[model samples]
Target: MTRTSRRWAIAAAAFLAAPVLAGCAAGFDATTVKHYSPTEARATTVRGIQISQGFVLGPEPGGKLPKGGSAPVYLSLTNIEQQDDQLVGVAVNNAGTVKLAAPIVLPRDKRVSTSGAAAPGATPTAGTAGPPLVIEGLTKELAGGEYIAMSLQFANAGAVDLTLPVVARSREFATWAPAPAPTTQQTPTTGPTPAATATPVPTATATLTATEDASTGGH
Candidate 1:
């Protein structure tokens, strides 16, 4: 009822609400946002090598990566070992060949990524600084949102198998570049053709008879 009592009640209410507002702010912190978190890309660790954001770039929206065709691969690798390593090979089931543009050299404690700028805040490295991964001659058709069996080999780290997901070229993946189409090589022709030979003409011979003229003179 008094003026001082009313003021004291208002101050107490403000003090109590501050803590609740602070708790709510922490609940919605930007760092906790889903976009800032790791994506749905598959990840695994093998022999101290960390592979993340590993996926196959599937066909365009409403399309499928045709059988006997090709698709691009995107991933990031971090070598946690002291010595360097190299990605020597890659294989996919129902796929003919998984081609790496160059030897992916994983420097010690460095990160290499094939997805080119997909990994946020990833630094450049000998392996990640170059071209993309391409899987050619797919034996089976692939639509988006599917997983395929795959294996990766390292010179020193040995081989690691994975079930990599095939994602459509939409949303966050839309900005990521796709692997270039496989080049078609023509078969070379055989040696030049042989030439035809010509036949020789027989020589004409003419014999003159002088004996008839001599007989006429004698007569």
Candidate 2:
């Protein structure tokens, strides 16, 4: 085609596409929906045992984690009793016996292995993975004792305090890193001497690179 004819054809195609594009965008505004939801007030609990899964050992607030990350306490819980109960507030104690103000949330997931996990002393196995509900901003609350302890407060369930066993938390598996091999250091002293009878000393320090056990935890 001639140059002028080609230009005219291009203009005509542009004009034809305008209406189609306009139609596609025409009802977009009306189809858009507004979203709204009211802020929910926290719930209160009446009565139920405060059960937990993972055990927080001498856990401390503001303490350092291994990977230079925010230290967090992994948690899960349930009412244990048949009847449902409300959960209210919680009190936390740091490495001391004193109490600290805190909020308690029994963030339980039915999708998880209900029976928390085996204790860390078990064999290694595939561990659980899921969205963890941050119970709350946990910090040291109380003072008096040398160790940490948390007391949960509820409206209905005053002190049906429950003890949730420390299930295994297998970052890699749902078991402990296999029981540590028994050391020979405590074997015996060839000849006993009062001052020399200290703990058995190994000639060399050897690091374990791999496990020799054939069985313990599942892959």
Per-structure clash totals for the candidates:
1, 23
The per-residue C-alpha lDDT of model 2 at residue 147 equals: 26
* lDDT value, residue 38 of candidate 2: 10
Q: Give each prediction's root-mean-square deviation over alpha carbons.
A: 11.5, 27.3
Which candidate number has the best TM-score?
1
Q: Please give the CA lDDT of all the candidate structures.
A: 0.73, 0.33
Give the alpha carbon lDDT tens digit for every residue of 108-196 in model 1: 88777776564775654344433457888888887765677888989889988988777777767777767676668999989978887
Best lDDT goes to which candidate? 1
Estimate, for each residue in 1-219, the C-alpha lDDT of model 2 and write its tens digit: 999999999999999999677666755322112111111101223244533343332122222222211112233345555554444554444322222223333333211111224223221112322212112332433111122245555554575332211112223223322211224667665875557557877634332322423233434
Model 1 misplaced regions, further than 4 Å:
1-38, 123-131, 184-219
